[model samples]
Target: MAVAATPSAPIFVVADDHPMVRDALALSLGAAFPGAQVEFAGSLGETLMAVERRPDADLVILDLDMPGMNGMAGLAQLRSSHASVPVAIVSAARSPALMRQAVEMGAAGFIPKFTPSQEITDAIRDILAGAVWLPEVARDHQLAPVEADLALRAAQLTPQQHRVLALMAQGKPNKVIAFEMQITEPTVKSHVTEILRRLGVQSRTQAVIVAQKLGMEPPAAKGS
Candidate 1:
């Protein structure tokens, strides 16, 4: 019988826009992997940078609602760019169907935000061991078929397109998105066109509705 091999310098990354969440994940992972190197990224861009900086990373756990990710689009980008590195979704959304979709889309696992720290550490270990980590009962948790369909549609978008869609979901005007993204209005318009086309919706409201159903929502104002 062959023994399992653990990473000699495992680099586990926890990507989330929320600072506290990132810190918590880091603490749990640090304890679980002991000598493992853990990195923290706040957005998809940072996550990609982390990937570039730590090519030897063994696993990446990301929040689906993080900035610039546009949901599962970030997951697809990571998998496509770094096929050798395993990725997982750690988000507030807790739908079994979404978890299934993420695994189907190439994620090593789906870890919901509510998961206890101990369980999360265990999940990270299992994924590092080359096993799929999922809630035992989520395998049977029923979801509307539309959720899975939307998730697949979401996977088809480019990373930039996903960011555009995210801004639209926040009800940000094109000018605002342009200013925030530092792109020309025309470029933003182009992204919107593709976002609408890929989402199979004619307008932004409808597009936002689709994402909301998938548990994608803009966090309330800082003090709200």
Candidate 2:
């Protein structure tokens, strides 16, 4: 779905430690939405400063593992300081616990660090439309309350893809996943690719993030 345009362009804030990653994300957003404005922050201090300077950001894409101030802590602070601005967790950690924590902490959605550009755009659009972007399992398990449509959409994933997603969320590499599942490395690679496609993510980190948002646990090793 396309993001609805407003008379005033929506402002965005992105906080991440890696300069290249931050720039890449900004570039991707710029390409996707030509008129929108984005502000970058490399640390929590910088993020706070940017927010103070421009208290009109419509969305904040937050990284939860930054130096000095952890992502969750920063998020809490941001919420306290700017209660109205919506926040989205965009992190590398894919643990279900973390994703649950993000929602409980009042994030509008949880977007994985490796999510594809299109998925990221979709998430932003959805959030702006006042819809939460959580996975179906998370809703079913009561990890978070979500829209029925989001839950139904998540339920469409295949069982094998679900297993693959669970393993990836546990930080398992493709080779380790292959060995544990008794599948060939190439097969694992293919599954990983398919999982990313299904999740609308561009990288493993993003896929793992999405898996956690769905309330998925790590897959058991082949022999337990």
Candidate 3:
């Protein structure tokens, strides 16, 4: 099903690595909206693919701990790539703090894994209606300045820059990063330069430091 262009039917991409969790979310979306179409992806990679297939996706329910997505990077990636879609995080470890950060990074909502099916539906509906749906408690906790800055910086890195930064964090040189990323050395150098510039760092070490501190690993950043 395509992401909705009209309210008559909406499409939701529910991303989680766990099969059971995916099934549960699909069921919840199905039950909540009789005509809604829900698709499932086991990880952030799959989620991105699904979004590519349906760039007009109405909403996305993402797993916070899905493989390849750490901290706020996955949320950032999705928000940046699919700016029109309203995305939300669904996690077993939901918290007021994380929710605030997700919202600050551009999430449309935050749905706790423990949220009842009814509330989940309500939250999704609210977001689709152009409202920011978040837990009441999350409104009280704002990210510290450093964390906010980190989240913003991570969000700024493109997928290739993220990959280069990740390898650099492990102390890999340009040659190794190019090999691992299956790109040319010059491309790797370009990525490194962009990474440093985006992270506001003067050098590789500083870029890695900033990336790791900001949790900049996206699923595709594992190299080409």
Candidate 4:
């Protein structure tokens, strides 16, 4: 009998409101796998749009306290819309019950917000390898569960901005991205400026944090 083929390189989408966080994550993922493809979404609406556009994405890195759509609700929405896509929650809210709930709601794993960059990548790699990404805290807290319903709010984004954000998350320079995407460098810079404003960050490094909190890769050294 023939053996099944190994899974392809995983594609990731990060949903967070921090520019430095997103930038950091994009950098980290790029460094980790060299050619791995990664994308970013600053809000719930953008997150949904990304999934719709790239339904075959291997995984999603989600955050808990986004501006409009809370992390839990977004997770549920994603579960409902794309039941097949795997999800991993990366958040600073260290609630055991919530982590368990996320898993029950179809999340493949949970990465604590302060986890090292390498750990984050390791979790993604584990999930991609068909292993669970839950921390020990989650397993222990599963016994005593608290009941809470996190609500999600509505948000919107322009299609053009969404595409620009996706390319930016791939670690492309403005000029190169503009050329490849058929837009002017000035336009690309404007989109990036708008991204920082909407995400409420001053620098790209800060955006990376937000991205990592959302489960996206960070720009720092793998273990640093």
The parts of candidate 4 lying over 4 Å away from their true place are: 1-8, 141-224
Computed on alpha carbons, the lDDT of every model, listed in order, comes to 0.77, 0.67, 0.72, 0.64
Most lDDT-accurate candidate: 1
- Residue 151, model 3: lDDT of 53
How accurate locally is residue 211 in candidate 4, as Cα lDDT from 0 to 100? Answer: 37
The model with the greatest TM-score is: 1
| Alpha-carbon TM-score of each model against the true structure | 0.78, 0.58, 0.69, 0.60
Local accuracy of candidate 4 as per-residue lDDT tens digits, 1-224: 01122355457788777877877777776666655667788887788888888798888888765643433546666777888888888877675555665676678888887999998888878988888778876674443422222100011223344345444554667898689769899998887777666556687665444333433332333235
Positional deviation of residue 217's Cα in model 1 after best superposition, in angstroms: 1.8
- Candidate 2 per-residue lDDT over residues 84-106, each given as its tens digit: 88888787665544565557657
Residue 55 shift from truth in candidate 1, angstroms: 0.5
Model 1 over residues 83-148: C-alpha lDDT tens digits? 888898887776665676678778899888788889888888888889998776345355456665
TM-score quality measure for candidate 3 = 0.69
lDDT of 4 at 181: 61
- The Cα error of candidate 4 at residue 1, in Å, is 42
Which segments of candidate 3 are over 4 A away from where they belong? 1-7, 52-56, 64-82, 91-106, 110-119, 134-141, 169-173, 216-224
Runs with alpha carbons beyond 4 Å of true place in candidate 2: 1-7, 135-137, 142-224
